[model samples]
Target: MSPMLDPRRLTPRPIPHLPEISKRFDGVVNCSDDTNIEGWKKLLRDDRPMKLAAGSISVVEIESKVLTTGFLEFDFVVEGTGDAPEIQILCAESYENDMDKGQPRSKDDRTNFRTGKLYGPTDTYFCNTKLSRNHYEPFWWRTFRYLRISVSCPPTSSLIFNSITYRSTHYPLPITTSVSSTDLVDKLHSTSVNTLLNCMHETHEDCPYYEQSQFAMDTRSQLLFSYTISHSDLLARKTIHEFYASRRDDGLLETHFPNPGRGMNIPQFSLYWIFMLQDHMIHFHDLALVKRYIGTADGILDHFAGRLNEKGLVGKFEVEGTWAFVDWVGEWFTPVKGFSSMGVPKAYYEKGAATVNSLVYALALKSAAEMCTALGRNDTTTEYLERAESIIQAVNEHCYDVKNGIYLDGPGATGQYSQHVQIFAVLADAVNGEAARTLMRRTIRERETLGLAKASFAMSFYLFRAAVKAGIYEEVWEELLSPWKKMLDQNLTTWAESESMVRSDCHGWSATPMYEIMREIVGVKSGWNETKIIPRVDLVNEMRGSFVVAGGDTVDVSWGESKQVKLKASKDMEVELVLRATSIHIKLLQGEEQCFSWT
Candidate 1:
């Protein structure tokens, strides 16, 4: 099915033309204005061109209020000439030191351009000494908060810098959601939106810098977050189709689609593709789209089912050139005898099955079963559920640590514990009710003391899910968000790849707060074609927000001290309100505002 045929799909919007918020110029001469910075400002404000004399080398730096992705554009005029001048445009998320060592530098002041140096991708343009009215713009989009344009001219040529502007580009997603709460929550929400914007271009990239490959796991979370703020699913649909096209002969997906290098696969990431398919079904309700990929889901599950060991738990991927990555916990960075480690748990190398992998398979089976049921394939649905149940049962029996009241990384692998196993245990239904709640509670409380490897930014999404399932989201809300809060405190304009902050500083996987804030704090949950509002009244006294529902309608909600809710919808639909252990159903008429209050 062509995604463009969908009536509900939003049309792409035009990219905006933006001027820099601030500018700085160094070593600039022969301008009409008194100072170089003033000259640049006049060029932006009054359309006056800044002229540079011959034999001058100058740097012009510009800053945006936040991170942005765009095309750098400028016009230049060269009059008297000997040799063509060279201009280089450099973009960076932040200025830093010791970039070669991969060390984390203090970036608390992103606007302090003079303190540090810019380190990122650069584009160079050599001007024509004889040509006039030269317009320069790179073909590829550049992501940055700070941009520097350096111009060097020979002694015989004078250069004229006419104008500089940024033609900002994104997926053209209109943000239909808003959150009005504490300062921290507000900043986190806005920062998350910026981070997601930067990571989204032609595909959902892990980060704008370093590697822009679309990994299944990262794309899954990014799609969910996108659904909460915007009704447009064109990008999501494209991603699903691309991943489906990237399926290998063995029924597993490549680690990241559109990869031109050697073939690589991560067994767990294929399972994430199943989760992505199910997520699409829930938000968009496109049965045709799901039907097209349902067989592919089966192919993936079948491969994992064939790999189950004697204990009924899914074993590690033994295929050559495959990585069994679970999480990026520091303790999981085990050194191999002949090769470098990639943060794979030591238990995976030991003699037993990894609980995280088995649990992830079980979860994917459950998701696939839901899609099958939606497609009216009852037999396939039952088979998938049964398969999932068996894996959950096997994990509970073999991987559970009875004495410690925790699940080990693998069967009989003593002292092997991690937050990933426990998070998945609750998600895959290896445990339930109070047991699940208690397990998650203990997992969070004793993680440091028990030496349990913590979940990084990517796995934290599941960590938050497990918390919500255990009904402890309100209780541990602030604690679970400490990582994001720390990032905010560190003056990070975008989310970091991990708490270590050594790699990419703008990873979309770290934008989980965008989803969590909308779903949990504001309490807008997607239910097929309906909307569920279950605001966390206990934690938040008053809040107001709006988000797009499955039916391509905007639902606005506001609640405050009177325990009153004011809701408005664009179409006639059923809005379910759950408050203080009571469920109330209300019929919201089209184009009418409804108010409900609880004692």
Candidate 2:
């Protein structure tokens, strides 16, 4: 294996724009309270909308030739004799359809002369002509396919732009991977990858347009997605360093890092930091990097070790006023009748031992144990494993409903359940095989099942993983596509934070489709010494793909027509071809290829 590079030295790889596109003014008209171009067309200049004043306001619609590119920063040179025409540039991903809502869409598509032109970070900005620069760019990059440059200048001022173009930027990693499947599957995969590219900035942002926070839960999916598509671990390593940098005096990690102020504390987010570390080691297998962070992992474990309840489950936050958020579940966050106003139910969140929290803690402990064992810290491993087992026993006895055959949300929860605890149960191996299958079928699989709400975008990753463990790939794919297609129907260019009228249009957590296609559908999982090739032929009749995996090996896999499957690797590599939960081990010299049929 090649020696690992220092991840700290990684820099942003700028993706320069192709030869500039010459865009022409489609028309000069008034667009007010309009959500679609057709809606704007219905309103003429004669209507004299409140915001679109007669001479003071004019919407300059710029249309570019059909050029396919990911949305990034737009550079515009606004040259005007008077007051540098205040401009609001709106970018869109699809111009052919109403999906190009001219600008970012909000629930309230109203026209207000005061703030109507403002939307998120892409709002109106006045160019500084005296600063020795004629061009204007925002603090962050904006995503778009079409640009709606709204220049509102005074009646006496004439405004014209010399050069208006866009420059795309990302981690600049090469796309050393390919996925081939059905047409719809291909589109889904592209959308997922696009979401990841947009979400990744200086640090892994949850979304570029909104919040712009580097959230651990959100970036975890993006990290895994990058490994499959980009085949680089630099960003993942950088993210781990950032999370460790955000560690508090008490050793807890922040929900979002590099905060302007002290970071917001979420007890569960700190636990996810541990999971992220383990996940990175699993994919990259850089022992030096893993060893460097083992102490940080120990610090995190130490923080939680002091908070375990008598029953050995993490109870309430010993650190006062800390948010013990598990997921955005109504049961966890939304107060029941008769509780205090403006706060979540204490029993569900702060007070009792939550099944989700304890299970995740147990999983984290087990993960830490594995990492410790890998690092030759057997004492730490034994300690973590034993503690994890105690918590698991406590969870099964206290949280699991013996009669209902499912886990409760918390020890105090009675009829109150969710897909989260059960999913985590399978992930932690607290439940497996028949028990897990039964739990998922009863709690998660059935559409008519009503007790628990579905997972939010952040938690859906685990939902997918647990479903796979339970051998529910069919249901997993179906469940995965529903929300994604819904977003597509709404013409969302980037993944949404939730399936609602939320402010953030783009989020990294929702970029699950691409990672699943590569990992689950194509089944290319990486390890330090070898890569595991396990394509799920059951999901699709014909599936074929190639990806550069861990240790710099290019793997090509195809399963079709007959049960026979073809596989190949570009380097001397060891591979585990997993089928029906059984692993078939194989090895190859450099540039070797082989084909095998599944029985």
Candidate 3:
């Protein structure tokens, strides 16, 4: 029988950030005085219309006097009523680095430039005198660091703006975590924080610039980072509840939450939903709150469990309309021999389970077992653990090529391989120690030859985790610099959806490096009673940072010298300090501190 728990005791505590205030556009881009108004109008005409550009393509520039967050609404008051006038405003949180800039009529590329700007531009607001109100305001709040406003009226009529206001709105949450380093890690951290803040609203958005949808894969990364940096679970909890609310008839959770208009399904995404709850449990320890969704988790596992074949693998899900998507790149499908572009392997896409999917299933099952154990559901835990072990053994037997020291995409050990399969193997504990180390090294070196699926920002979270877990700290550190710095080089204030040309430039998933910095570099892993600190000191020569773990307790760590590490706890907390091959455990009473050194 499940243990009885009080729901009230599981309510998450508040973490506060300063409230956002309204800020007006710094100044008009092309038109400051009446003389320049015509020029601005002309530029607007040259620019694509709102329906053509997902965002405004060309217009007069308007900057905020100071950069601010939480852009909510825009208000414009037109003085002069000779004839009904129309105006268009383009908004962008990062205008100068915007991908839509200067590409007014670019053909639709599906992601950013999809036909019909239903989502509008990164920031596009339109107002016409149809409503007969002198003041115009949009229905919803927008995000932007800049705006481009254009006014159009009857040739003989005069239009003047008496007042203009841009209101910003967001769940006010303070930036509690801090990171200071001698390298550009701090810049990456700050930018990642900005991305997270932008994507965070009523729910966690994949990217505020584009879809503004809360995706499972994206939310998983944002949720982990939010706990470490924001030190709050309010948004995370809201997101969890939202996803649970999207449960489908077949026991699969929808790919995204607040389902805009139509319902959609992704088989792999449902797996992520399970993992998400596990993460929530680890960070918040609110079993009572999590108990509300045990049915959702069980339903998902039951559905998948029924489909396992003789080899303990879930083959192609024959459910109609089900999208078996694993990641953005098509390489998620088993790659064709001697072919660079990834396509569905007819053998597996129709009859066999993709190794990537199998590993995810095992990991999800493992996570379920942990959640069950926490809730005192020993029976469910045993069932899930057994199923997870079976899948793991099957994966190693079918997917791993002992001769090549690599993992294939599917059964029969296809010559084709991807970094994805191996990464998840480590994460699921299906591979460990020397086996994990060798696979990671080969993944990096044989990347080109194997057509190893390149990880976009979203998958990079697992890729980094697997790399760190393999005890290859230096490589993980070195690998992080390029992808992020490229975004910076492109003048992006936030990480892009992928390095793709026609994708949303600001994506929350790309912010994995921030979580890595706090979790792996500082090495803070929170538990119900004890927090673990296993610093990857080799990654950086000298570093200092602080993060709040599960119980709303702040922990700080710094090491300047080669072999010394210092830690301070804000409250009484038990911590385990792990070195390369050894661990030093300590218990600190209230307001206590400790330092350790090793050679």
| Predictions in order: lDDT | 0.82, 0.68, 0.69
Model 1 over residues 258-286: C-alpha lDDT tens digits? 78964657888999999999988888888
Model 3 C-alpha lDDT per residue in residues 1-599, reported as the tens digit of each score: 77697455654444344355765555544433545554444323332112212222233455554333444343333334345455677665443323355554321322221122322364333344444335556666666655656555554333444445656655666666788976577878888887777787777888776678988878888888787786567777778888888888778888888877545466778888787888888777889977998889999888888778888887777546666666666544444322311333333563377788888888998898989999999999999899889999998888787877787778874676777888899999999999888788777667888678766678888888888789775764666558887666655566777753345656888888788778887888886556899888877668787777766778888887757888888887778889876888887676656778877
Better of 1 and 2 by lDDT: 1
Model 3 residue 27 distance off true place after TM-score fit, in angstroms = 6.1
Candidate whose TM-score is highest: 1
In candidate 1 the C-alpha lDDT for residue 310 amounts to 92
Give candidate 3 misplaced runs (Cα > 4 Å). 1-20, 26-59, 64-81, 92-133, 162-165, 260-262, 330-351, 561-564, 579-582, 587-599
In order of listing, the candidates' clash counts read: 0, 1, 14
RMSD of each: 5.2, 7.7, 7.5
TM-score for each predicted model, relative to the true structure: 0.90, 0.80, 0.81
lDDT of 3 at 68: 39
Candidate ordering by lDDT (highest first): 1, 3, 2
Candidate 2: residue pairs that collide: 92-145
